[model samples]
Target chain A: MNKFYKNILGGKAGIIGLAILAVLLLVVLPSSLQIFRLNLVGKYLTYAFVSVGLVLLWGNAGVLSLGQGIFFGLGGYCMAMFLKLEASDPITTKIQSTPGIPDFMDWNQLTALPAIWVPFKSLPFSLFAVVAVPALLAFILGSAMFKRRVGGVYFSVITQAFALILSLGIDGNQGLTGGRNGITDLRTLWGWDIRSESAQYVLYFVCCLLLIGCILVGRFVVSSRMGRLLLAMKDREDRVLFSGYDVASFKVFVYCLSAAMCGIGGALFVLQVGFISPSLVGIVPSIEMVIFAAVGGKMSLLGAVYGTLAVNTGKSLFSENFPQLWLFLMGGLFIAVVMFFPNGLAGLWESARARLSRLSPRSGAAKKIIPMPAMPQASNLVETEPKLP
Target chain B: MLAYSLSEIWSILIMQGFSGLSLFSVLLLMALGLAVIFGQMGVVNLAHGEFMALGAYTVYLSSQLTEAYAPGFAPYYFVFAIGIAFCVAALVGGLVEWGMMRFLYKRPLDTLLATWGLSLIMQQAFRSIFGAREVTPTLPEWLMGSFKPTETIDIPINGVFVMALSLLLTAGVTLFMFRSRIGLRTRATVQNRAMSEAVGINTGLIDRFTFALGCGIAGVAGAAFTTIGSTGPDSGSRYIVDTFLVVVFGGSASMLGTIVSALGIAQTQSISEFFLEGTMGKVTTLMAIVFILMIRPKGLFPSKVRS
Candidate 1:
């Protein structure tokens, strides 16, 4: 139990970090910010789910999926479908040509609910679909790609193409998937007024707690034996494969796990934001999700959350003041993050702490500081086998 | 399913095929540059589309200038513009290679991210310079009308012109790559960088020029694009995925593969678009490419080289 606590919770430093994140998210922000601002933060925390997933998939497993938005959008759309159905109750939607169906469906001349959407009517089903749908898709995609050993840049490109296809598919299917306008006017979840300020506050807390839960899950994964295998596989896949482990299965497992996390984030996103759209599920948003992971120190679970928060905050601020400049700033951030700070904020924090400990002679002497070995740098995370023809 | 007459179906097929050829040319142009950058240098340049856009904007600018200051040169400005676009885009590509890409040779994924950033910056720059609205160059009178090969089949002259230009560029590139001394050096460097360097070939310069050449081709693509569609700040982004897919669907290294894949993709998309909705056609095309890629992970004609 002691070992479990230490390994899973990341020992003393990890516990402290979790405590700080919890207090800040649950106590500090909720108490300080207005409901509107808190809701926005809640929305940003949803992306933190994806960032955390990226830490596991990209950071540890060495698989860079540029289409996380597909999972996020799927989850959001699943929740939105249920909420839309509830919102479009027969009594409320009697004015439409076909009552009880979503307004977008009516607009697109869908007389009855589509077969795909029928399962989403139940809350339990919708919730399950949120995670399962993305996981299933991830499982299919991951298995196909990994089993063939199609990885590295090819994987990223294929994932991106998938993102494009999904967005285009949704946008094209106007009657079925709500098209470009998306499944909007989402309100009420199981007789509860989700739009109310009190509900928003509750949802924010729920999001924070769920986010923390995900981080813990991530920490547990990273500190386990599987994590060591993942690290080894990432640096040297050939060696790992030669060592008699099913390498493809591990990759698929991690990929599906990340997809599930993104799905949860997406569901929470729909809950907080009141609508789900194709705009948030496309190639652009998919790549942006990666930046969150990249900016947060892809290797650090806690850093992913902080990175998402920091980048989103900066985006909100920049876009609000100078919308035109935001793209430039964002571009600069992408370049700067990749070029100079490859390991992200977590890396910076680790190095800073190392430097501080080295400088403080008294503390070092009193604590009998054991000189730790250097952490693996991002540069070493290159593909061992050449991908070029 | 059989709604139309046989001749009508033939005409529709012919016209769609012609339009597909235009798309093929544009895609081929874009993919050629990408193939060179990705296959030769192993750099995943997400910003290659921006170079194409740079070329497009150059044509737009030249058109604007010709109309404003040199009205007599309006008919002739387009030919010069294509060349100027290539030069301008190549210059920018070379600068980017020197400033950014040189530092990211060992890190292909990092290059992808950095190039994405570079693309974003370029998009914003385009937005700032030319307002957010899409712009098109005024084509020469000769390039405007259609060539009626059949009574019903009205093939757009611009489409034919773009195809011819792409063919010319492709042939030139093929010759330059296979026949030229610099091309030999580039191939040698790509095959073995350390060996090439030890043999006194300036590998860094080769890398820069190869990247520039790729961007230059993309610029020509952009120039060709203006005849088909308008140029926007985000136009490059719209094509980036399709271009990357084309390059990947083809074996990344093989020019012949790139051409074949471009043709296959363009034809599939255009013909499908004729029957299905616009977005559905795109979805179908992308899905097909992905499916093919899954079956053959290294692409249709992967080069036989030992890792």
Candidate 2:
């Protein structure tokens, strides 16, 4: 238990980062922002969940899954299905041709509840499906690709294709998946009005708490022995494979973990935003999620959170004011981030601190500062490290 | 399914197959450029689609100009416009290669992100220049009509023209790649960068030229694309995934693989659309490609390489 706690918190630096993030999300933002703005932040924080997962899968494991939106959408859709069911009670939906089905189903002329959606009528089952569905998918895809020794650009392209397939599938099945309009008019969750201001505040807190929890979970994984193997595998797959470890299993596990994290984020997104749509499940949104991780410093879990907030906040501000310039600015951001800042915001902060310490009068003491153990250089030689049995 | 006569089914299949052939031509054109860039150089140019879009807009601009200033030259202008589109797209492609791609050769993933950025910038530029709405160029009268090969089977003249152009372009590219001295040097570099450099090959110049040439083909593709459909700021994006899939599914390095895969993908998609909804057909096509990729991760024809 003590070792687990240490893994989750890292050392002093991780604790400090976690504390700062907690204060900002749980205390500072809530105290400062209006309900409307806080809700927006909550929505942004939900995306942070995906970015955090990317840091684990892409940054740490060197496996970039561009179809994260699939998991996110799956989770959101699961929640939306439950809420829609709750909203479509026989008494309330009596005016429709089908007295107990969702309105979209009625509009699509679905006479009965589809067999697929029947299981989602149970709240516990729906909640379970939110994470399980995404995880199951990741397990299948990850095993298929990794076991075959497929990595790098091929994996990225294939994942993007999956995202495309999912979005089109959802868009095509109007009655089953709510089509392009998506699962809307989600009024309640088991008779609790989710659209209420108080509920929004509560959901916001829930999102923040869950986000922090996810970061800790990510921190745990990154600090574990599995994390070392992942790093070693990323740089030298042949060496790791020759070491008798099942590389594919490790990759599949991390991928599944990331998918589950995205699932939670999507569910929270539906809860906070009051709707879920196919727009969130496509190739574009999946790639955009990657940028959030890239912007935050894919290596830093906390940086992923900050990256999501910063980029999303920038997106909102730019689109709200100078809508025309947003795409250009976003494009430039992508270019600049890749060209100038490959390591992202965390790398910049680390460098700035290094420079500041170098300029300080206590340079001798500064020289003793520990290099961040987590942000290992890409070319870091595994041969220099102690051998793990 | 049983409603149509056997002869009618044959005619319907012929027409659908011809339509698929037009799609195959466009896919081949787009994939050819991607093959050169990604297959030879190992750089994921996400902005390849945008380069294609650039060619389309160039053709659109030329059409508008000829209509306004020189009505008499309208018919001949399309042939020139396609050439102009190639030059413009190639010039821009060369600039982008010099400015961005050169720095990202070692980092394939980073190249993807950077080109995605380039694509966004290109898309926004297109939106700013050409309004957000789609614009279709006026085809020459000769390019507009259908060619009725039989009473039951009619093919669009533009489809035939585009197919011929793509075949010409493909043949030209194949010859240039196999027969030319530069092509040999490009192949040498792909096989062994260090050895090629030792042999006095100017690899950097080859990279830039090949990238530009690829972009030029994409431009021609854009010109071909304008004949069939309208061009919008985001139209290139729609095709980017499908084109990339074709290049990948074909086995990236092999030109023959790309052509075959393009034909297979297009026919499957078109035929499936006949049986299913439009989006469902797309989903089915994509799912099949992904499933095939899972089994054969190296694609249909895995190229022999030392690595």
Candidate 3:
């Protein structure tokens, strides 16, 4: 029992439990338990999952992908395609129902469910595809990019272009993908009643738990040697390369992990929201995820969760109250965070801890209780000496 | 007397070219401001479009004022307001540069993020003040109507005027950049900031004036644009992407590049529209540009190095 508690507190076990709980609360609990706050929490958890993945890839890799929405959208559209197909009437009825021909087999009169969509009838394959597709793509892209060692603004610009192309492509191909308006109107997931107030509440609960799990796991990952190497690469790439670590592999690992996490987030979001639209995944939303991390504290695992909830909540209210100025307000928040608080909300907490310790120098417990400030100061060597290991 | 005579065909072609030139001129003007900002300051300046919007709103306000207080001089007020919008937008540009952009210089990505935020604010502010629907600016009577150059083509009087104005403006700006003391200093600052700083130049002051100048030119573009098109709070959003494309395709660092790319893009787009359907033309042009960018990421006129 002591070992279990110690291991949990030590980080790895704690993170696993957190991840399990989060998945359960988000994926399992909502439909089963019927809790309300948990559903909202579940939604945020999905966002957190994506945000943390961003931290892993962008935050550590020093390659700011302003178009992660491509992966997020891919996962969303895939799942949406399945749901849209299922509720849609089958073959003979579909042929009778569809005008002229389906967008896909346009020449063909056969309106039966396409072979591509058959796997989606089962939950697992759709789930696997959503995560796997993005993983494969990012893995390939990351390998090509890292091998060449493309860095700085050029890399940033290219990724942004990639995002633009994806958005435009999806918008252009409306027949199969549902195009600009995106897929909607379906309200059930698998066999469960998606509209049931009880189901929604349970979903929200699971989301909250999943979020906690993501935080713990994120904390564990960043706390590991792999995390240290990511930070090192971010700061001193050449040095890390000389130190004999396969920088390419490290990057590819993070890239795929982030993509997979984004997939999970997208899947959870679709399940809860009962719809998936390409609108949710785009350069803007992808960029917004970055803002959440930057605002919450890029270095801190918990900050992603904190930033997502805070900014999204602000977006919800301010967008309604001051529709015109909402962007300005959001910009003000971003500027405020970046300029004044580069370390984000987490940094502020760290500073507060530092001040408390300073106020009571004689209190020996302050040394142990305070740990390290969360700020990613250049001089973190002295401040974070003890707790890092 | 013949409609297809060489003289008539020549005149019609000249008229078409004139319209093309006018379109190119405005595009150049907008592109120039963006070039200066990106060139001198190393900022992508997403809010460049918003600055243009600010200028348009200034014109709108001035129009409203003239209608209410001085009906006789309402038309003349437009000419006057164009200048004012330049100064007004420049002033706002300077303030934003100092408050937000100055701090973000060290972190380029943060600058992109921050400016994006600022753009949203500017967009919403305009939406609230100007309303969502586009504002219709009543053009001066003299500026409206077309001049028949030949049997086939009827050229708008304003198109010729706009073309002439754009040429004069470009000539004036080129002279200012090449010959004037402050202009030379601005160019020097862009060329070699560290060296210029070492030689006792105030790079910071140069940055301010450069940003202001670029924004001022955008104001002029916005004022001129109100003649033919719709001006709304979100008008900036429409132009921002195009301006960036112009700047990026032309090469972010050069005034000459901005002019050439703008003219080239405008001609291709217009001519393509003549050939293909509206959207296909756009798609084709966008694809062609994207393909070009793939080959030359720094754009047509890239500076050799980041410094």
Candidate 4:
């Protein structure tokens, strides 16, 4: 029974954590939250996908990408293209000078759809493109940088530069993209009304299911040999490289995987939010995505999802009432999370659990103490083992 | 597009080249401070541009004060403002280093996120105080207007002033780093923190002072920047990526590389803009930087060092 418990849930705490998230997503949120608010939660859950990917990439592999928004935007734009085309059908857009093409293109005096838009007309193609585009981009970028041994701060700044370039490109190409306003007024997906109450509820459940799947994927990866290799790489890249591991390939694979995750999130974000824009793919939003991961507990995939919900909720609440103080509050959260709670919300939970277990009467015999290294290595990156005593 | 004569095109290229030089000066000023902080301390300070913005705001405030109460002092207020900008930025940098940065020295990624948060606060603070509009200080008579170096090659006096200021600061920084006792200690601490501490060097003080000095230079850069560009709450953010690119492209630890990369990036961006659309120009420059970095990940001029 004990072995089964450990194998299935990883730990007793994991079972409880999973149960709580399931209740929140499957029961409480759909019943309690109104359509408007439920849709907002769905939007926030899309960001959770990115944060979960960040848990794997940053927490495990020590690759802190500040440009996940690029993937997210790419995914979102792909989905938006299909929906925009459907909404701008010849019958619907007959009043415009150019019918059948997207309104923005018509407004910009383009007679035909751009070559890129042609492939996105089919739902299967759009769905495939949503994941493929970001994965391809990440693969190219990751291989280029990682193969050349560019990791750490240089990798981060270069990614941010990429984000800047993409936003600039999208915002400038008004005819192709919708410009600053983004692809909005998205009406349907395959003749189903997206803005309806029933549709919103259905999409929310779909988002929750996808999020759970992502968590399971994260759990599986973290428990596998590849996960151990990532941790090893993070702590000792040189040692891993010396051990005959193709470190760059692993990094590239993880990066591409993470990009694919963000891409999925971005596509979902558009579906729920009804818009996709350049603003969401820019430097500021990209960094904000990192903050969500950091705040949630970069180390925990489930915690990252919760963190996204918590931060986004706080953001909407604060911005609605006190717009001016939001930035200061966010800034304070960033500093506090890093300085006091490096492991974030999940770390707090773990520490609390340890304390609770120790306070129990039978704790002395039940607790298992892990031994520390004789002389802790001089490297600052060494992970400190948790102590029960 | 090529309707102009060959001579006209020649003058246009020269004019654009000079404009690029002006951009190079600003980029160098911002990258210099970032290089010091990131290279020596290994802290990715996202708030570095905000320090520059603080400097720009200082100049604007002083100009306003001079215009309202002391018109006679308007001619010399910019010089005084430049000094004040450095001192103010340095003081804030020292406090931040002491209060927050000291604790985060071990976690570079955390430092990056925390500093980004700090930058958001700073940007909002500026917005609250200065309002959302961009502001520029009125140029004094001496600093205003362009002079013709040749009939077709006119250059703004303010741009020249900024370039001269950048040259002066770069020379001063070089002399201080290679010539001074504190410079020696800073380098020692960066090279071997434990050894420097063992040898009785106050590593903590070195860190604080180095961070402050770096920020101070960024402040002066901001003051110089106000002469060329307008300042707003988000002004710092706009330049942050470009400044970081300059630092990374030049090889983070090499001061000479920072200068060269700054000039190269600025010129490429400026010249390319003349040929392509403005957005495309920026895209091309960024792509070039990424491509170059892929081929030579250590950057164009990596310093010889072993960690």
Candidate 5:
């Protein structure tokens, strides 16, 4: 049984984490959460996708990108454009000046669908775009920045500029894109009513499945040889470079992979929320996504989901009653977490377990804290003696 | 592009150029503060804009007080208000540094997040205190009106005043950073923390004073801003990205680079805005900066340091 458990769960802590996820999915969500709350949780889960990516890119690769929302919004907009086009078919939008164009296009007096929106008409193409566009953009950006050796805070600021520019572009182009109101009024996906309760439940399950898949993928990457390279690079880039590794390639690859994850999340977000807008593509949301990763224990993949949920839940609950206090609390949380709890919830959990073990003094128990090599016991490296003269 | 006579194009260029100067002034002022904080100290103060806003709000409040209590002081109230704004922002900045920022000096990204949170809190506070709507301070009578050197081009007095103020502050800061005793210590600490500590420099004190000084400058920038733009809760945030861009694109720690980059960015944005759509103009400028930074990752004028 122990061998079987080890094979399946990897460790005792892993088993506990899996048990929690199972209970949340199979029992708690189905039995306790109503359709409305369940849908909200699903929306929150979409954010988890970005945080999970951040865990890999920022936590492991040591790349702090303040613009993950750009990928998320890109993925969302891709799906949203497809749905918008389908909903704005010739028959439904016949009353408009432009019969087949989206309502925003009709309002802005465009006669034909823009070239960019054409490929989105194909479901397969749009689905591909959900993953491909963000990843491609990330690849271009990552190559440009990383190849030039612009890491650290410089990378964060540049990515943020990209986010700002993307949002401004979307907001300005009212005719081609949907503008500030965003692409909304999405009804069906391949002739299925996404707004229905049953459909919502199905999407919730789909979200859960995808989330689990992402976690497993992240685990696989982080446990692999490349993951160790990422850690080494994070701690000392010069060392990694000297060791005959193309550090830039690893950075580009990890960043692109993270972008793809965020893109998937954004696509799912559009499905659940039924809208995609420039507002979500901007600097604020991008930074908030980073905070989600930070809050979750950047080191832990599963912790990312928990952190997203905790922060979002706190936001909703606080904003509902005392809107003014929420910002103060959030700001305080950021400062406090960074100052005191640098490792976040996962760190807190490990430390608590360590303290418990110390109190119990358990023999032959699996020790979580790996002890470091002891320094020399002697205070002085060279002893000075009068006889030496 | 819009077709026009050669003379008409020349006049339009002059007009756009003057407008760009105002933008340049604002960007320069904001970037100076950011250069000191993010560039020199390596601490990303995301709430730097809030400091600017605080200055704007201080000016607004003083204007109200002068109008209500001392109608005679209305003309000269702005001069005093600028000073008050600087002091208030500096005090708050010092408090924040002592209470929060000092702890996270080792972590840059954490500093960004913490300051971002501070920005949110400040924004909400501004909203609550000053109402959600934008507030504008009444300009002195002398600071009003415009002067036209040509038939087609007109320059506002306030714009000129703001530009002059930015120049004076820039010069003052340049001198302080290069020549002042505290500035010497600050630079030493930045270059080698352990060495500065060994030499009996209070690095902690220097950090606090430097942060406060940056915030104070941002406050002055806000004061200059009120001459052209109305004060709003989130107005500071709107400029934060632009300011950061100016600092980064100019080469973070280089004063000359900050000035040149600010001028280049402002002109690019304002001039392109004349021909292209507003969004397109902004997008074009940002994309250009990103591309240039890609090529010159250290930026236009990176400071030299031995690894």
Candidate 6:
């Protein structure tokens, strides 16, 4: 009984809304005029996968982790490792005879394959890693942090530090991580050639379908009593602790889930871009992921999608057109968003809807909505974030 | 066999110590700015490295200008450039604080995100303005040579100068914070913004100065850093993570914590680098910090918990 489902599925209007979304996703099928928007729609859907997790962690759990990109990078690197191992084998087996063998092995004077990389030669193992590494890391870090009564900025800092160290570690071990060059020259994902347009079309659709599933899962998690309790933790951790709830477990659970979803996004990203690197896993990219979540909206699942699409799409277009001043424009854009649109594009929609409903009070077809504050937020580092007493 | 003369070994140790101290100075400079901005102002300025870059670029530009326009006094133009760079960086810091961050003082995470986005923009800006290549700055003639206590142990004079300058800067900053009227007010505001404001302090101005002072220090660090390393668009990122680590490990909002943590990290990094390769050294130091932080999450000297 999620509000989203109630709004768009329980009633007749909900069915209509569902139909509209379906139509939007399949815009190219019914009309030739909408063909151009198809690819963009798919790309946005992929971005939404990352954003959905943000909504769960930042919006409900009230943890503003600034290193989602690390999770994404882990996932992307996992997938890329499999793809590269499969691809590099043809050229590398002559000098080396191992499943996980890479070109750098010859360069590093190692004829034998590294033990840790052996399992990744299999596709399933890589997929497992995409989910495993980030989950394990998040679990360990989140457990230690939450168990010690650390949240807010301390949590943010520690997570950022974790990301920096990981990326740097990967860079330092050049043979294992492919150094700064990263794994590239990807041929295909499984049997599907990535360079093919038809393959991309399927991949993009998969992103859209997965995005819907991701959203559904997020909604489900956030609607349960557990979700309510977690939100309450955000509002007041001490009170939650006093109530005999294991706040540490709850935080670790959500942190792992967020990391998993980010991993999924990372996998999809490598599939789309056909490349992965240490740079993609660094602190800057990690921070950028948080920014994408921030600029989109921190309240709803849809906002994560909205934020990533807006920022990424805006960057691609603006940087291409005005290479000299795009950054200044982006800086100005962030200033505008934070100052005026605190809730991001999601807030913009809410305001627009409010104005429309206010214009005709007598028409009570749709009720005005004011969302409740989900959690306690008295302990933000800079007096920023929503504080509830 | 790793055999060497006693004097040779002495020189090696001295040289490494000088380099280590110089490296420590740079870390302190970067950490100091980060501490003030993050500690006092509560805005995690992610583009801090960019501000440092601006300082280096300012020095580079000033040198070019002086050489072209006033050849006789070209060598002395560095002092003027450092001042200009400090002002420009401070102004940029003020602009960032007043523009985007002023509103985000409430959402620390939002400030982190927004400032990070701003950092991307700044990097691109720098790349476009000054070509992406490293902008190397040559020091004056008097500062170029090495100090030779022994034939085998010649230490770079520039490194010694950097260490000296860092000590002077730290002492100067200490006086500014504890001795000056404005500095005390800034410290007061950081302690308790609401309390300070109720007592007739202009908390807003204090925020600006705190931010500007941090950026100015970063600018000076950038100017000094030019002699030791190549300045480039993304070079600031190199120091930023270490700076954050120092700021966090030392204790947020404590100047003494900043210095202690910085010196500790720098020395560890240098000594480990000598024993291990660069990567292993960094990994060891970071693991140590992580373990330390696990024990004390709020850091070594974090603000006392409010009841």
> Best-fitting candidate, measured by DockQ?
2
Evaluate model 4: give its TM-score: 0.94
DockQ of each: 0.85, 0.88, 0.38, 0.78, 0.78, 0.58
Ranking of candidates on DockQ, top first: 2, 1, 4, 5, 6, 3
A1-389, model 3: which lDDT tens digit per residue? Answer: 55444432444534554565455545664556435555555666677777888777767666677767778777776676666655553452345445333334332334554566677777678878888988997887677666667555555555665566566666665555566767775556676777687777666655565556555565556655567667777777776676566777888888887887777788778778877776676556777888888877776566677777778877877877867557777878777877888888878877786678779756664565455423233234324534322
Model 6 agreement with the true structure over A171-226: per-residue lDDT tens digits? 88887778788878787777678767777667777776777667667766776556
**Candidate ordering by lDDT (highest first):** 2, 1, 4, 5, 6, 3
Which tens-of-lDDT digit does each residue in B1-307 have in candidate 6? 2798777787778878876777788888888788888877767887888889888988888887777788888667777777898898999888877876777887786676677667767787888888989988655776688877766777777777677777878888889888999998988887777898999999988887888889988898888787777789889877777888899899887888888888888888889989987987898898899789988987888876242
Model 5 residue pairs with clashes: none
Candidates' chain B TM-scores in the order shown? 0.96, 0.97, 0.92, 0.97, 0.96, 0.96
In the range B1-307, model 4's lDDT, one tens digit per residue, is 5798887788888888889998899888889899889877878999999999999999999899899999998888889999999999999999999999998888788888889988988999999999999999987789989998777878899988988998888889888888999999999998889999999999999999999999988899998898888999989988899998898889878889999999999999998888898888988998898888889888889867667
Q: TM-scores for chain A, candidates in order?
A: 0.94, 0.95, 0.82, 0.92, 0.92, 0.86
Off by over 4 Å in 3: A1-38, A91-96, A99-123, A136-150, A205-221, A224-226, A236-253, A320-325, A360-389, B1-26, B147-171, B263-291
For candidate 6, the C-alpha RMSD (Å) to the true structure equals: 4.4
TM-score order, best first, reads 2, 1, 4, 5, 6, 3
Off by over 4 Å in 1: A363-389, B1-7
Which residue pairs of candidate 1 clash?
none
- The candidate maximizing TM-score is 2
Q: Can you tell me which runs of candidate 6 are displaced by over 4 Å?
A: A1-22, A26-45, A88-92, A95-100, A188-197, A360-362, A370-389, B305-307
Quality of candidate 3's docking, in CAPRI categories?
A: acceptable
In candidate 2 the C-alpha lDDT for residue A183 amounts to 92
Model 5 per-residue lDDT tens digits across residues A1-389: 66545543546767679779867875797679899988899999999999999999999888999999999999999999999988888999889987988999999988888898999999999999999999999999999889999988889989999999999999999998889999999989999988899998988888888888888778777765577678868877886676567889999999999999999999999999899999999999999998888888888888898899999999999999998889888877877778888778877877776677777757334265533111221212123211111
lDDT, residue B228, candidate 6: 75
- Winner by lDDT: 2
Q: What is the DockQ score, from 0 to 1, of model 2?
A: 0.88
Task: Show how many residue pairs clash in every candidate, following the order shown.
Answer: 0, 0, 20, 0, 0, 10
- Write down the DockQ of candidate 3: 0.38
